[model samples]
Every structure is written in C-alpha cells, then in structure tokens.
Target: MNAPASAIEQLQLGLPELDWITDPNRIQRLSQDFSWFSPVLTRQLEGKVADAVVRPRTEEQIRQVVAACARLKLPLTLRGSGTGNYGQTTPLAGGVVLDMTSFNELLWLRPGLARAQAGIRLNEIEKAAQAEGQELRCMPSTYRSATLGGLFGGGFGGVGSINYGPLAAPGNVVGLKAMTIEPEPQIIELRGAEAMRMHHLWGTNGLVLELEIGLAPAQPWLETLAVFDDFDAALAFADQLARAPGLDKREVAFLASPVPDYLTQLAESLPKGCHAVLSLVAEAGEEALAELVSAHGGRVSYRRTAAEVSKSHKTLMEYTWNHTTLHALRVDKSLTYLQTTFTPGEYVRQITELSRRYAGEVFMHAEFLRNMEGQTNCSALQIVRFTTEERLQQIIDEHRAYGVRINNPHTFIVEDGKAGGDLPEDVLAMKARFDPLGLLNPGKLRGWPVGAAS
Candidate 1:
C-alpha cells in the first residue's frame, strides 16, 4: 500500500530523461477524473489505479516518454486537468499516466487565432487572448480548470457553442500538433479533416502537444439570470434569442423549478416556484435581451456585468451545463445524469412526454446550442432520480425510442449510440497510420481491442 519505488523506477529505466512520480497518493489522484459523475463508471472502475505517473515538461520530453512507452508496450494514458467526466484519464491497463500540466505556455497570438501548449488552463489562454482582443470560440463549463487539450480530447461543447458550434465543428479547431507512439515518435501537425481524427478519441491515439485554435472577437457580456412563470416559456424565450439576428449571446441555458432550487448561492435571487433561464448575452444587446424575455413572458431575476460577476467570484455558466448536475449531486448523492440531444422544433413535445412518462424521476435541463451547420438545437443533461442501474438504462431506452440521441456517459469505450459513438473509419485509419504499435491508452478504445491492431 506504500508508494511503489519500482513503479517509478520502471519509467526511469524506460525513459531516463523525464520527471516521474511513484508516490501512491499522487498516482492515485492523477489516475482519477470526474468520471465518478456516472454511477455506472463508479461501479466499473472502482479500485482501478495507475501504476505510475510521468510528468513531461516539454514536447521533447513527451516524445521521449511516448517512444519509451511504445518500446516497453506500456499503456500510456495522457492526462490534462483530468476535468473530463468519462474515465479518459484513468489507466485501465495500469501503466504510465503522461501528465501534461507542466507543458503550459502561451506560445503566440495572431489576429484571429492563437497557439498554446496543450496543458495551459483554458482560463489562462482566455486571459492572454482577452489582452489581445480575442477569446476562445467555445469552452466547457470547467472553463477555469480544464486544459484546452483535455477539451479537445473528451469534451463536446458548452458556453460558446451557441455561436461557434461544437469543437468538432469546422473552423473551431484550426489545427493540432500530435505525437504518435513508436520507438522513435514523430510529431504530426494535423489540419482540416485530418486534425479531427484525434478529437474526442479519449487520448487513445496519441498525445496532443500544442494546438492552434480559432478565436472570436472579445465582447463585454452581461451575465443575466432571468425568472419565468413556466419552464417551457423560459426555454422558448432562450431558443428565440438563440436564433435572433443582431443579438449576440455566449451561453444560454434553461433550468426548471427544482433544478434552480438546488442552487444555494442564487437561492435568494430565484423565486420559489419560478423557472430560470441563465444566459451571458453581449453587453450591447442587453436591451434586445430584455425585450425578448418580456415578449416571451419572463422577467429578469438577476443581472450582473461580467466585471461584476467576476468580482463576486461566481459565474452563471458554472450554474449551467454539467455544473448544474454537479450542484444537484452536492445536495443529494443519489442522483445521476443523462447526456441527450433533442431535435429543433420538437423540444416542447418531447420534453412534455418525457416529463409525463418519467414524471419526477427525470428532471429537465436543456442547454441551447448550434450544430456544425449553424442550425439551432439543444442538448439535455437531465438529472435522474436513481433507483437502480437497470432502471437507468430503461430511461435511456425510452428516450431513444422517442428518437432522442443519448451520449452514454456510463461507458468509457469510444463507441456509443450516436454517429460519433460508433468509431469512425477516419479515426481508425489515423490510428492505423500513427499508432501501429498500439501502445497509447490501450484498453480505452473498444474498436481497437487488445492486440487487434497487432
């Protein structure tokens, strides 16, 4: 149970040119992520721990580590901030965890794009870009803590997805610099369609070193939390504002009754029975936002400028997205969540039916977003009242029967129920080309079953 000297010694033996960690406590912490958010994963991956952790300071050190792991056939799982909900950072094969935090650095900033090392905290990048009059296109709710590389590796989309679309959406990611696993690794700069091969691959293919991402012009935002007579109206108004022309917005989320009740920090602002629609609209568009809310039968419950919100040290975004699920879990440990996407015009109908069918079991929370084609849509991160694992799958089945897409968070395998769920040929082809040895994060990808590539 003590720190294993041999674990660190093996890494040192393999790659003597790196800083390594074998302290059992630190190794255990490095091996975990928010994957516990899913009860299924908690049960499945419980007690699974990494054997060692190797922290790389530069891209050269990463190359040396990847090459060593490939030679030793050690499953090297890449670790960013480990803010991912899936067990993307957990080493199923019990090998070396390649920690990337030390690689943090802001390399450069151009007019419409910026380049930075993989381990840089998103907030760090945002601050640098803001100083240069730009900001990240879209960021996950864990904005301040999550590294941009982790965002590309496991995240979907959040705050800025309303306008910039998902991370996989074209133009969001300009390019990525990746290093393949082999005796002598090579850093490959992937661009256009090629860069996407590594996206959401769960760091199973290669280690991302640096990324060149597209940026949006910086804007002063008004952090507004509005109240509504009904959940439906709040959602409808948010949808209207999402599509409204000339009105710029960053994040827009609709949280129903009990969901808002779970937020203790804003308990005084939100009415007891009222639903809430949280958003970060452009400061210049505040008038338009107010008009839209009034027209849709809602009133502004709380309003703060970005500067004011920052002063309070709480962001409305932290109250939306998976943050909503996290807050509820803080209050009641018995709840889990479902990641779902709904069609454009049928949100009302589908929401009504799901509410009636599951009733109090599944509570509705929708975050409005735009797809790759710039079409308006929403992904629901519904909080569920836990009964049993079988019942959870049944709820998922019911939703799928209604044509809703569920991105199963319970499973660590790359394949799921959606198009992205099934391993795409593009990624497979990329792996075949880059990771011929099959040493990087071996057990995480189902498509590349143990030694299948061999």
Candidate 2:
C-alpha cells in the first residue's frame, strides 16, 4: 500500500465537493466502535485517524469518491453504524473512511419485498413496512442502531434466527445494488443467488449502495419473560420452543444466568434465585406457549399482551439479546465477551458445566438459532468481567479447547454468511475482475486474493 499522503490536503483535492473531516480527535472517534471485550486492543486496531472521513449522501457522490480514490491509489474503507464486533470496519490502514449513514432512504416497499438505501437503520425500514402490514423477515439484536448496509456486510444470527435462519440465506436477500472497485468503479444490481452470496461479505466484495430484502406479513406478537429454577430447565424450554410446531414466529429467545445481572432488570418482577428465558411470539400461540413452559418446569414471570407487544415493537426490537448483554456489562466496569456456537443436543449440560467451572469469571447468555439442516443450533455469547488481558486470552483459549467454535468477540466482526464458504475458482476470478487493484476490504471474504494488507 502507498504511504498515506498529507491527510487533509489529499482528501480536499481528491473530492473537493464532498465533506471531509481531518481533525485528529474526530477522526479517531470515527475509527473505533463499541467493541468493549478488548478495549486496549480495540483502540490499537483502530489506531490513527484517516487523512479524511467522507460521508456521501448519493450514489453519484459515492461513485465520484471511489473514482477519485482509485485514481490516487488511496485505500477506502466502508462504514455503516459501526455496530460490528469484529473490527470489520476499523481502518487498520488509514485512508478515506466512507461513512455510509447519510445515504439512508426507503426506496421501495411492495408485497413480499422492500428496498432501501444502504444507510437506512433496520428499525426505520421495519416501521415503514409495519405501517403497510408487513415487516423485515430477520434482524440482528442491534436493529435499532444497525444500518442496512452494516447488517448486510457484518451481521449474523439474532433472536429471530430460529425461524428465518441467518441473514445470508437466499430466502432473506432478494437483491442488492453495489459499487465495485474495478478499473472504473461501476454500479451493478444483482438478484437471486448472486445477491445472496454478497450478504455478510464484510464489505470486501464491494460497497453496497442499496438493498432489496424479502419481507414477512406483520403479526400481533406477544412478549413473555419466563424464569426457571435451574439452568437445565431454561435450556430445555428454549430447545423445545424451537422445535415446537405452530409457533407463529419465534422472534427472540434468550437464556440468561445470574452472572449477567442485566436480566435482573428485565426479570425484576420475578422472585429471587432463578435463571430466565425470554421470548416473543404471535398472540395466537399464547395457549400453546403456556403449555410448553409448564412442561419444562418454567413459569411466565412477565407477560405483555399482543396489544402491548405491538405498541412496543420498536423498543422490543431494540433490546434484542445483545442489548440485554450490553446492559449487564455496563453494571460492571471490567467486562468483556466471547462468541461461540454449540449444537442443541447437549446444550444444557455443556453450558451448565462451563458456567460452573468459570464460576464468578464468566456469565452465560445464549441466543437460539437453527442450523442449515433445521436442527437446533445456538450461539452463546459469554461476557466476562475484566481481568488481565493475558487472562482473558487464556479464557478464550480454554473455552475453545472444549470443542466449541469461538469467534473472538474482542473485534467488531462476526464470522458467518456465504463469505465463510469455499467458493468456485471462477468466483475468485470474478472478484479479481471487479477489484483489479485489490482495494476493496482486501483480506476479508472467501477466495479473497492473499498477500493484501488487512
């Protein structure tokens, strides 16, 4: 990569019409994200301010900026709401940080589909769809603050994953308009299988300009928070709920233990000495849901009727599993997290053992989802109170030693989507075709050419 030119003047002359921020403090702030698991390393990775941070409001503006960067041989990094956890958007090599938030717009909403500008918040688009008696098919825990482009580029399974699967599945993405960094950056619209491949590529393949997604009919949902006397019962209940037929929509499911006092707030009305399982469902399944809880030795501690849940959709959506975990971490100044996936067969026993082993050091918080085979698969995000950075690394190493696949949570990125797949050689060739200069998020995505600086 070329040595960065004088930050302010280079960007000023490169895209004279675009707004550019060169102040050291402001640039530093834009470079980092909400990744608290490894605060010190997070800051290190987000080191140095870009010569300029540019926010483009129109596709034309984005293209113009890209064209100028290509001409100057400057690296460009794309950013959305910065809600990612894997350092995916952090400018490791400072260049022009393209803030995509200003491009927010709801471009189209028709039966079974909705399209919006890359920068639109997930909640904003869902609200517009709900007014038309429809809604987003799936959204991550951070929907309220997460932008559409951010989710497409850097999101994974959320509370609703049990029903809709991961966001990268073909059923979720219908099309996308992206700007590639070939000899001449050009805007291209892709649909069907091709578009699905682009979902969750971590902004490596190209910069998403707009998104067309599949939508689901809006249903009156009932929210329930249940408390279990033991962790075993909570995990079993969640697994049973996932397998239960006639579940209108198992939107969000979470199992929390005492370590994460955040649940103490949501389950405040519950009696002491109990773990909790929270869920959201369509109103029509209330009777059946009650039976399922009873069968698993659990009781609904707090219930929001369909009317209440509907009225509070925006708030409920914002506090998905991750938000709950974030709130708990805030209670303790020294807390970080871990991301791991496990099969449902022995989830209860495995989690219980691990929690007991780590005891005061680790808190167990789980979000349920389904594997590609339709079997129960889950991602458990473990938040641990702060300790030495070396000890934290040891904890992650120990957890992985037990056979769980851990996607280190210290970064703003999550590993999932088609980007995780081994693509055909032609697919790699195609990437080279669009990114001849190898300037797009270089080291990310499958088949991404090697030897490019991350």
Candidate 3:
C-alpha cells in the first residue's frame, strides 16, 4: 500500500538538505505524464502513483538520492518535463520519484558538440548552441518544454531527423553520463555506440546526469505549408522536396484532408477538402521548394521564416508527429495513433495498401525521414478513430500481416517489438550492472526481474 519503509524513513531522516514533496496533491501531479494520450495506457495507469517525490538540485544530491534508494530497496522513477506521450514516467510500482527538472545547467558548448545537465530544456540547449553558430541535430515536437535528457531517453527523432537520423543513429548523441543505483552510486560514462544502451530506455536502466551531443550548423529554417486538391500530388511534392539536392529539409509531413481540418490554429491556411504538406525547409531553398510545389500541382499556402514564427509562436513542427494526435484529440477525444515505419522501396506501397483498407477510420499522417542507412524513407504517426480495443488490435494484426511494422503507442515498454523486435539484451545487461535491484522504474518494463526481459 505504501513505499518501502526503510526508503521513506532514510530519505526523510537522512536527507534534510533535499527538497522532498510529501503533499499528495503535488506528488499525484508529478507522478503523471501524457499517458492519457493513449486510452489503453490511461485505463491501466489512471490511479497509479509514486509514494513521494524528491528533487535533487545537483549531481551530488542525485547520487545521494540514488544511494539511499538503493540501500533501502526503493523503486526510483526519473522524470523530466513530463511532456512524454507514453507512460514513460508513470510509477506503476510506488516508490520515490527523482524529479530531474531542477538539475538544469549548461555544462559546456563547442562548435560541433554541446554538453549539459540532463534536466535542461531542449529549447535552451538549441538556443545556447545557436548562439555558438551550431544547433541540435534533432529535437522533439515538444521542444519548448521537453528536457533534452527526457527527449533523448524517451524520444527517437523529430524535425531534424530528416537530415540527421534518429537519436541512436551514428553520432547524434556522442556522450552520456549516468548514475547507477547503489549504496555508493557509481558513475557510468558512455561514449560512441555504447551510449545506445540508454538512448531511449525511458530511464529504466541508468539515471542520466549529463549529455554531450553532436551539433550541426544552425540553419535559417522556414516553416511552410503546401495545400493540394489531390492527396497523391501532395505526397509526390513532399517526396520530391525531401530528395531535392541543395534543399535543406527538416520536416516533410503529409496530412490528409480532415487531418488539417482538425488543426484549429491553421484552419484558415489549409483549404477545405484539400490535403497538406507541412515542411521546415532552409530559407535558401524556398524558391526551389515553391517551384517544386507548383510543378506537383499544389500551392504553397503558408510560409514564415523561423524568426517570424518565433515572434508569432506558431510552429509547423507541432502539426507533425505525435503532436498531430494531440491536436486531433482536442477536436475528437475518441482518437489514437500508431507509430508505423515504411522502409525504403516498399513504403509507398505499404502506406497505399493500409490507406486503401482503413480509409477514413485511420487517416494517414506521414513524416518523411532518412533512415540510419541514409535511405529516404518515412514513418507514420497516423491518427486513428478509436472504436474498440479489439478493433485496434485487429488493425495492428492486419498491418503485421502485410509486413507493415507498427509500434503500439498504447503500451509503455522499452521492448515494443517495433525497432529491434527481439529483446534488448545490451540494455537489460546494463540495467543489471547499474541497478542490480532492478529498482529503477520497475513496472514500466514488463520484462522485470531481468529474466522476463530476455
């Protein structure tokens, strides 16, 4: 019914220097994430909560909190910004929640790389990088509020992924410093491909402290939307722009008619009964992009420079990815999403097949991307009109039958059989060494006890 007595007592008695939250109301708020985005996750984790919340202001305080939780055998869930869509921060098994937001600090910055405390907001990191003539290679749609560490831990890729690839791809993230849960917490520094061990583990393995990420030259990005009477024309224009040389493309998102209709903020920009392509292209390529759009039988409906967009606080990024689901949900609460990847060569066919079958029930929303192999491809964050759980499962099964991979957002687990399909042995092995007690974000991983993970 409560957290381990030893952990609570030791944390309360030993750490008077720390900020501990005992108020049920505040703790309840801290214990939640955007899990309500998924009806299935909402139903399962609606009432779950953490016993207490401990905010560690510094890395030393974090080590102390880890040592105490480890010694007392308390499950610890790490949270940052709480902007994640899945129940990545939900404490299914009650314990101490180590709030990492207060651990904000920019450690260092260079021309090609930047390092900072995990709790620093991603927008802050990008701003700091931009000041140095550099930028984050990729960022989530929730860039304004999402912490860089949380984004790295729970997110894969976003706007910049078109040019740079996912978080774990090559040099997107070059370094990571994590703290193991032990009586005397040990520090683990991961570099190169080794850091992939915790890239998107949802803070289930190691507690991230600081990160050193690779940077790209900051671009004068333009957020533009192209409207088309034919959905196929929109997709063709997007595909052409994505592979166009000398054209710097960040996000090339394709949305069917009603999808843009649900985007209340830009409803006027998108004509009724027309499909849309929301893109973030470099300022230098605007003329070429517009030309391509015209050639594809479409019109460039909306265009704004990054600085202008910042002044207006209107971003095309939010209309893509999972954020599309967020906007659609506001219009119709009975809607969900699926993370589907259509690999190179056959992705168009796969999308066409599913689109033909699902039709209006599952509206297509695609973000064109380049996979790790540098192949031009795409992933779907399609908005689904939720009917029943059984129907959802049937759709997923149908996709799998057609060799279309689907990552069910409705479930929260590191191993969703989407990316790797098989068990993540390296991640699990690292967890055993770092959190031998498996006390870090326990039930978030159904593969608890380590054996189940295998």
Most accurate candidate by lDDT = 3
Over the stretch 1-454, how does candidate 2's per-residue lDDT look in tens digits? 9777563467577677887776788787777566544665565574544666888888888888888777666667788988876666666556778899999999989998999999999989888998999978788778878899999887776756777777866678888888887437887888877776555656766778999988888877777777788777877887778767778765545555664345445546456657767678788999999998999898887888767765665445444556756766667657777777775586766777888899877878777776666666677777777677788778877877887777666633323322133655555655665566766654445344333633
Model 3 TM: 0.96
Per-residue lDDT over 1-454 for candidate 1, one digit per residue giving the tens place of the 0 to 100 score:
8875563466587676678787899999999999888899999888878788888898888877777777667777889999888888988778788889999999999988989999999999998899988998999889899998999998898889999889999888889898878888887889978898888888887678888999999998899888998767887787788788799999888787778878888898888867888999999999999999899898898999978976887778788889999999998989899999888777767776776677688888888888877888888899998989999988888888889889888887777524245577888888877788776777777766655534
Show model 3 residue runs off by greater than 4 Å: 1-6, 417-422, 449-454
Give lDDT for model 3: 0.85
Model 1 TM-score on a 0 to 1 scale? 0.95
TM-score of 2: 0.88
Models 1 onward score TM values of: 0.95, 0.88, 0.96
Tell me, by TM-score, which candidate is best.
3
Each prediction's Cα RMSD?
Answer: 2.6, 3.8, 2.6
RMSD of 2: 3.8
Candidate 3 lDDT score at position 382: 91
